[model samples]
Target: MAVITGGTRGIGLATARLLAAEGADVVLVSRNADEAVRVADDVARTTGRRVLGLAANTTDDAAVGAMADAVERDMGGAHILVNCAAEPAGQKAVPAPSEAQWASLASHMDTKVMGYLRCARALLPGMRRAGWGRIINVSGLGARRTGDVVGTIRNVAVVALAKNLADELAGTGIAVTTVHPGLTRTEKVDAMLEARAKAEGHSTAEVEASMTQNLLMGRLPTAEDVAQVIAFLASPLSVTVNGVAIDVGGGVRGSINY
Candidate 1:
């Protein structure tokens, strides 16, 4: 079974659905119990795979512990973990941070960086016992290229964390990696696009096209596009690939790296 935080929407929800379709029983973890359960039920019905939802605030130690306990009791343990939880970036203003912005950025770090660590540590014992596991951290392209301090710092921290975890668990059966998604076409991105379209007096399609200009694929990636890669990393097929970041951004041209 797999446990995915932030599984109620966007890339997390897409990942859950795809994982379920591939015969993995999924535990969808969200801060909102009702939303998590609702999405879990929907995935279960659609994929005919066992899916459960449990609520937990990643930023809270007690809640994360409870979530780990519940997963152990209900699902026996998780073989895969995908860290996909984060507040919407739109909620915060950036581009030129002020002194007062430091506190907000620190809070963002606590949630994205520390939250991921808490979940990883909580579930490591179970994975160690199972002798096989995959932990995929859903970081963003901001790790490689960014225009804001909040995005860059948090994402780079995730990459660093994943690398360290991979090194610490090198001889074990667990494989840790990070996936960087860019300009993913999700409900959240669509909303942003629409708002920009309205504000700039340009069609939504035009704005979307502009967003894809830097990508070799010439189009924004769908959530499913990134989820497929996540599913692969969670499977036995990805046993040899560890401690690295994969770009699932339809190939950003200027940022190309070997």
Candidate 2:
């Protein structure tokens, strides 16, 4: 089974559905209990597989522990974890942010970086006991380039955290990896595209075209595209790839896949 944080919406939700379709029982972790339950039911119906939603604030230790306990009791145990919880990166594009800006950045770290750690710590004991597990931390392409300071720091931190976890658990049959998605076509991206189009006085199609021009594939990768990669990495098939970050960006310009 898989426990996917932030699984009520966007990439996390998509990943949960994909995993369920692939024959894995899934638990969708979210802060909103109602929304989580609603989406879980929808995904379970559509995929015809076992899927559940457990509400927990990832930043809260007691809440995370309770969620893990529920997962163990309801689904037997989590063999995979996909950490995708974080507040959306804000709109401020300041290269050199002020103190107030740093505070905003710090919130991202607290949620994206430390929140991931909380979930990992809570669920890892069960995984170690099972003697096989996969942890896929969702970072972003901002880790590869330098533009948004907050995005850079948060995403890079996730990569570092995943690598450390993977190495530390290397001999225990558990693999930890990170996936960096770039310009994925999700609801959030759609809203950003609409806003940019309005601001630029261009059609949404035009704005989308410009935004995707930098990608070698000439289009943004869909959420499912990224989700499939995560599901693969979360499965036994991912035994070979560990302690590394995999980019699912459809070949962003100047990106060297070493």
Candidate 3:
């Protein structure tokens, strides 16, 4: 069984779908219970994989605890847990933020960092009992790039947390890893592009073209692009790739010399 947080939309949704395609039973968690159920059913029907959808606000402790219970009750308690739910509200740079900005930044750590730990705390016991498990965190390239201040902080937080947690579980049967995916075309991107178009006096398509041209692949990646890598990591073949940072950006290089 696979439990994916923020599994109702964006990259989270795509990762869930990819796992289902690979024949893993999936349980996707998100704040919108209705959306989760609807999407899970659709994916179950389309991919022929058993899927569970549970409503959860990962930032809330009760919600995260309840989510683990729901998974145990509905989807066999998860043999795999994917921390894909991220708070992107703080994607903008500083100096433009408002008084309520801390909530936005705090929310990211609450959900992506501490929230992920809560899930791990609840689910790792079960996984350890099973003697096999996979925990994949979906942090983005922006975490290391730092061009976008807020994102870099959030991404870096998850990366550090993942590394620390993986070390703690070094000898366990479960494998923990992080995936850094580059620009992917999603609804969020479309909305951003639309906003950019209006602000820059250009069309959405034109803005999208410009954005894609700057990417290494000369095209924006789809949720499917990153999801494929996730499926591979969850596979048995990648058992030895623990505590590692894998990039799924189609050769998108950053400023780092390494």
Candidate 4:
């Protein structure tokens, strides 16, 4: 079974669908109860696999713990966890951010960094008992590049968190890894592009082309593209790739990650 936080949309939703289609019982977690159940039911109907939607705010320790307990009681236990419950990054850059912006950054960390840790802590017991598990952290390419300060920090922190967990869990059957997806084409990105095109008096296609000129692939990856990578990392095939961060951003031009 897989428990995916932030599983109602974007990469999380995509991952849930892919995992369910692959025959894994999936639990879609969101802060909003109605949306979570609705999406889970939709995925179940489409994929013909068991899918449950639960509500939890990852930033809250009690909520995360309760969610984990419910998953164990309702559907055996979670063998895989994908942490993607974070607010979208890309806040306006400031030379010196005000108190509120700084607070926002802290909130991001609480949700992305500490929140990942909390969920892992809650579900790890089942994994340990099963003697095998996969924990995939959904970080971002902002961990590699600059410009978005909050994005960079929180994503980098997630990488650090995954590495630390991987090291500590070495020799155990559990593997922890991080995936950094670049600006992928999700619903949110589509909406943003449409708004930008309207404001700039250009076609949405033109705006997208302008934005993606730096990509060597000449296009943005869809959420499904990223989900494929996550599914691999969540499988037994990923045992050799623990503690590593994989980039699923198609390809960026003129820069090398290594």
Give candidate 4 regions above 4 Å deviation: 91-100
**Candidate 2 stretches greater than 4 Å from native:** 95-100, 198-201
**Stretch of 10 with least lDDT, candidate 1:** 91-100
Weakest ten-residue segment in model 2 by summed lDDT: 91-100
Candidate 2 vs candidate 4, TM-score winner: 4
Quote the lDDT for 57 in model 2: 92
Per-residue alpha-carbon lDDT of candidate 2 for residues 6-35, written as tens digits (9 for 90 to 100): 998889988998999999999999999999
lDDT of 4 at 145: 81
Sorted on lDDT, best first, the list reads 4, 1, 2, 3
Model 3 global lDDT (CA atoms, 0 to 1): 0.82
TM-score of 4: 0.96
Best by lDDT: 4
lDDT of 1 at 58: 98
lDDT of 1 by residue, 56-112 (tens): 999999999999999999999999999999866754556564443877788889889
The per-model lDDT (C-alpha) reads 0.91, 0.89, 0.82, 0.93
Report residue 90 deviation for candidate 1 (angstroms).
4.0
lDDT of 3 by residue, 166-258 (tens): 888888878888998787777888788899999999998789778776567767778888888888888788877888788776665454434
